[model samples]
Target: MVNGPAGRPARSLTQTLPDGVRRTTLPSGLRVITEAIPTTRSAALGVWVGIGSRDEAPAMSGASHFLEHLLFKGTHKRTALQISAEIEAVGGETNAFTTKEYTCYYARVLDSDLPLAVDVLVDAVADSILDPADVETERGVILEEIAMHEDEPGDEVHDVFAEAIYGNHPLGRLISGTPESVTPMTRTQINNFYRKRYKAPEIVIAAAGNLDHATVVRLVRKALAGTPLDTGAAGPAQPRAGDKRVRVQKPHTVVLHRDTEQAHIVLGGVGLSRYDDRRFALGVLNNILGGGMSSRLFQEIREKRGLAYSVYSYAAQYADSGLFGVYAGCAPGKAGEVLDLIRQELERVASSGITAEELVRGKGMVKGSYVLGLEDTGSRMSRLAKSELLHGHLMSVDELLGRVDAVTIADVEKVAGDLLAHRHSLAVVGPFDEGAFPPG
Candidate 1:
């Protein structure tokens, strides 16, 4: 286990952001970040394109995601099977994903295979074959994937919440486009879309774990050498947020449809975006509210009142928008009461300022988590790339910890008050009644 600042071992495989991670950018617009650690024998490599669902236009809602799938089907020198076999043969794992604001392809491999990993990833993105047959099969696979997401209630409601919060913006759309759009996407459309977005200079390559920085950069540059120059054009911006309330009515009230003998519910509201200066304070409020077992939501709702088995609150920070959320699973009959309890806690926390003890705990948790992230190379690379994309610079560990530490009780109270105000939005799944939820 990797040790944190307080000397306790961390549980997450991707914890700890390394100070050794060096960052640089190529003239072609590719950001290069590297971390070298002696504790682990493996390394993680990734290329993060600063574009995602939000960047696509109405005519190409799922093109970014479709391109991600096509990249893995095959490249100029390797078949899809060959790419998979090569990575697995080296005891490495490779995959890619598309998010609202970014798309990334990554590999975690033995240190010796770092060069080979770089080659595979660079080729996959820069020189994909996008085979016609594979494209057809992937369309079917992605549609099924979309269906799978709908089948999971907890997952579906947040998508619903996103729709409610962001309205008709591209941000509200699913990362994977609809069955209708993806199924009918043609090869020419894919190629044209790829040329316009995928080759942007805003792409970033990041790596963490044991490796040589110069060697890794060299490998990346060499693999992608012959690729055409990036056009240097930024993608379109995401839509802004507004006061919008939308209720999606699917069949089945008290959708206690699942027989797990319990109901899952998620409550969320417009939180704070990445560039929002109050984000650090909101993070503190989240910690005190439901970020951990000792948090107020867990203590009062579960440990003290025995309302449910699990409870937590968190904030998802995006480039232009963010979400403050609370999630819990309770006995079917107690679901409505649990919602009341959560609101009550929100009101109480907002009106009555946090205690000194709570402040300490929240700060400690946030700082501790930040310190622990420096241990893995992949995390280091991800942090650099994400910070660059989201904040436009690399934030040192000390700087982040300072921000978390600087949060005051008043800061926490103010954010809680702002978040819990009537401007909030929510989504629920389970044996729930819409009447029971707090209205915006």
Candidate 2:
């Protein structure tokens, strides 16, 4: 598949990292990454495409998610049921999901069934038919899915908050576009998106669990030999680029009045990008602030005052922007007190920073979760793919733990002052009017 000068064998272009993980690029611009976990009997494989909602035009908002469904509907050589049956017959599973930055169709099977896994997953991604009748059938299913999501006030308010924060940017829209946008989306538009974005240059096949890198490569090469997917000359796509700044006019409030018992609130402001070095410090700050039961928010709001049962904070990082938010569930009448305490705690941290004891606790919690989570082959596969997709390099476990260890108390203070010192916005879902909101 190499595209060098005529008549010579094309040497592989690859980089093998620590932990025996390997990243290889085919001549056709397809990238493949794999990890061999000797103790595991099963293998997990994913075909990741680099197009998601952020890549869509305004009119094409939900196309990436829609294509996720269509790929499983059928392919040129296999019916939809047959496609799934093959995997299930081997005691395997197949599923897919779409996110803001990418889409993945993945499978888990016995290591002996890897060739079948590669063949089926590649066929689904590279050879789907996108039948007209199947498109129409899936339209109703997706509409009902939207209706299902909207019915849950807690779930829907996050989208409302995103719209409030991001305004008209594609990042502001729901992953499942509005009923209007998706209802009338046609097959021709979907086919065009698939043909254009689902190319070898933007695809990665990642595998973990018991496996061989050379054999996996050989299987993938034989799988697409004569197809239109055979690329003449191209390289992998560059990471998505856009600096759509969050344009909030001071602090704001977006309240959806659903007749619910507890107010679901998300409060805070813009924070770090995925590439920022300070993210390690930010993680520590999030932990001390509201990441666990022993965290400040959980201890103060839920345990001491009994104001809420679920109270926490989180950070969401993207290619060029991110969001940091604190979430709590409480009664409508107590919303004011909750917001005031939140503000007071943030002011305290912004002014004096967290104590040294808190830093050690935060580091311990982060390390525990990090190490335990990576014990799964699926988790390893995802990490390997995402590192290659976003950063174009792999960070070892030792390196990750070291980064967390390096976060100092002063680092926390400076980051707290920089991110949490500003006037922040609020989003609420409950039976409350604008007049009921707490002071900003």
Candidate 3:
């Protein structure tokens, strides 16, 4: 039997590992996790900054995402072109992204070039030259990106559905700010925002690959030393609205009319929060539904009937709350029938529990996938840091596998029932009749 977190006789995973993989913390509050795979000579390193759209204030909305792009433009020591050239010279890949709850910059390189990766990322964050000229250019680039999303019917619909689910909360806001918001953001505003939020020494730096723990510490320390600590803003709480049961129908037959071969249909509801205890059961339940082609949704909607090309159910787990959804693209004429099939599967999961074989397969698949995620250094580092940020501690791989295995058929039925009890807000982007979606 495994001991719990509070147990006196604690298990140590570090002691059993090879000498290179180590976990350490600095006095400045940065958590450094490194894993050295001797057989392989490549490494993946990532610095996860625990701030995203959810952290943005109304005035500084989309600042996190904007900062993500601006950081790559130039730094104190390296020009934008030089930064790209240097990484490419080492056969390394570098990129950054902003999500609802966090922003990250990462690179993958040969083990010998780990120091270069660390230096580039640290410099990008610290000496982020949010040049007024580059800021203006990037603003245009961001606006074009925003326009592209606006023009895309399927993407617009999902954004609408998210707004309906979260209402006026930050969760409802688009990660890419509106054209008006993105346009007026000045270089000063961008720099001030970065200085206040991201110029912190408290962020996490994790590397996975063939590397030394002490070496990683030295590189990170030297990279971040003497940087002003960020006394970050007390970001406002993202509102968690209760279950919503409503439907909004567009006046026109097809919204954002596009000339496409197939129609895009999105159906979903308010899902569980990251803190919810039933998250594991809910995840298993989703996996059994449309996570894999062998699942019920695929068999019923695609394989058997041949109604749609793709059908899947997913849950977007967030800090405060999440959304559970299913999406598919079907023949323009078969949208209604496809909806019925999806509803039937949802109702069946809620009413009649999955078979024993199905339960076993679902649990086994979840367990296998969990283990596979640790094979890559970047994946392991992300899993460790994200779990800590969201769950307040690290949960071992065995613990996660056990949780996935512990979900019973009854638990699946309960989660299904809870989700299906509410009417879903529908978002359809296609060429169809006005009465395509009835009121929920």
Candidate 4:
């Protein structure tokens, strides 16, 4: 059971073994969460703001991503070069990224240097001046980024698939908007966005590794002193829902011809949302189907048949909805055969489901990967931040492992049928856009 936030001096959310996490909300509505890891020498800290690409409107399509780049260009307190240089001088790593539901500015440094990290990350996220000249310069950089996204077949097909399956919803659009959308995004619009969305209540400050909860709280307080984020009254925004819940549409098989010799294709269907309890079972089923080197898809498509050099399956979980799909990059001539085989595999899984042996192997694979991924301070820090920002709760590693182990063959079979029996979508990028994408 978890304690409520009302009266406890510290909001102790979840604790496991040698580590425990605590949360405290400042008067300005800022939520600070920290995990004390006494053994590690490094710490990771991030400021997570709840606005992301999905929250943008038609005109401000790429504003969130744009701000991600522009914010580092310069803040009122430090120039862009000085910002990176200062962190580099301390042997720390700093970076930021924008996602569909939130954006995070993070830093990794020696535990002794935690103050520098907090100071810099806070300045970058909260004090960016949004200079006009810097905006114009980054515009070209963003344009090139958009151009770069166009050239990568493997990456572009997934976005095309999203547009096909999710329709015109913001979730379906590229995180980096088109050149047209980004080129004209002015400083005023972006500045206003930063002011409106980057509020205290909508943000979370999280730290992990060799840190004191009270010390982290003090550092964040000292860093934000007079900023609006130091004081606000709204509760955290509700997890993104609505259209995301009922947003998927008819299946689509879209093809965009390119001069590339290899064809990149994504075969996917609407998947269970982050809130779905079936996710644990689905994780095991995905492992057997295409998650690793020993999985069915990689074995059949790449090893046994040599149809593709790279083949794997993945699941993208979002707040209210998600996507499950397989990606195969193969020679243009093998596109048709690859698609056929993929469909056959889906049909087979949807019918008979995985075997008992597969169930054990899948569970082992998932649990092993889960445990191994958290071995680093950075990964642990990310885990804590994401749990707070996205899920709004923490599940201890043991509890998670237990859930993974509890999934039976029946659970996997039911989820396999439930997700795979639906109308799946396909997106292909090849030299034969005219003839490559086949009818459903």
The candidate that wins on TM-score is: 2
lDDT measured at residue 377 in model 4 versus the true structure, 0 to 100: 81
CA-only RMSD, every prediction = 8.9, 1.8, 6.4, 3.2
Global CA lDDT computed for model 1: 0.75
What is the lDDT of every predicted structure here?
0.75, 0.86, 0.74, 0.84
lDDT of 1 by residue, 342-381 (tens): 8788878878879989989998988888778766766766
- Top lDDT: which candidate number? 2
Q: What is the lDDT ranking, best to worst?
A: 2, 4, 1, 3
lDDT of 2 by residue, 249-337 (tens): 35688888889988888888787888889999999999999999999999999999999988899898888777888888898889888
Cα deviation at 341, candidate 3, in Å, is: 1.3
**lDDT of each residue in 202-292, candidate 3, tens digit only:** 3667787788877887898788765554222222122232344323233222233556667787777888877777888888888899989
Each model's TM-score, in the order given? Answer: 0.86, 0.96, 0.87, 0.94
Predicted structure 3: lDDT:
0.74
Regarding TM-score, does 2 or 4 come out ahead? 2
lDDT of 4 by residue, 1-440 (tens): 23347754333232332247787766555778888889999999988888899889988999999999987888778999989998989899999888888898899999999998998888788888889999999989999989988998888998988887777788898888888789788899999988998888788898889999888888888989765565534455555553435568788688888899899999988887788889999899889999899999999899999999988888888877888998999998898898889888988999988889999999999999999999888888888877877777888899999999999999999988988986688888888746456665
Candidate with the larger lDDT of 2 and 4? 2
For model 3, state the Cα shift of residue 10 in Å: 27
Error of 3 at 329 (Å): 0.7
Candidate 2, which ten residues in sequence have the lowest lDDT sum? 241-250
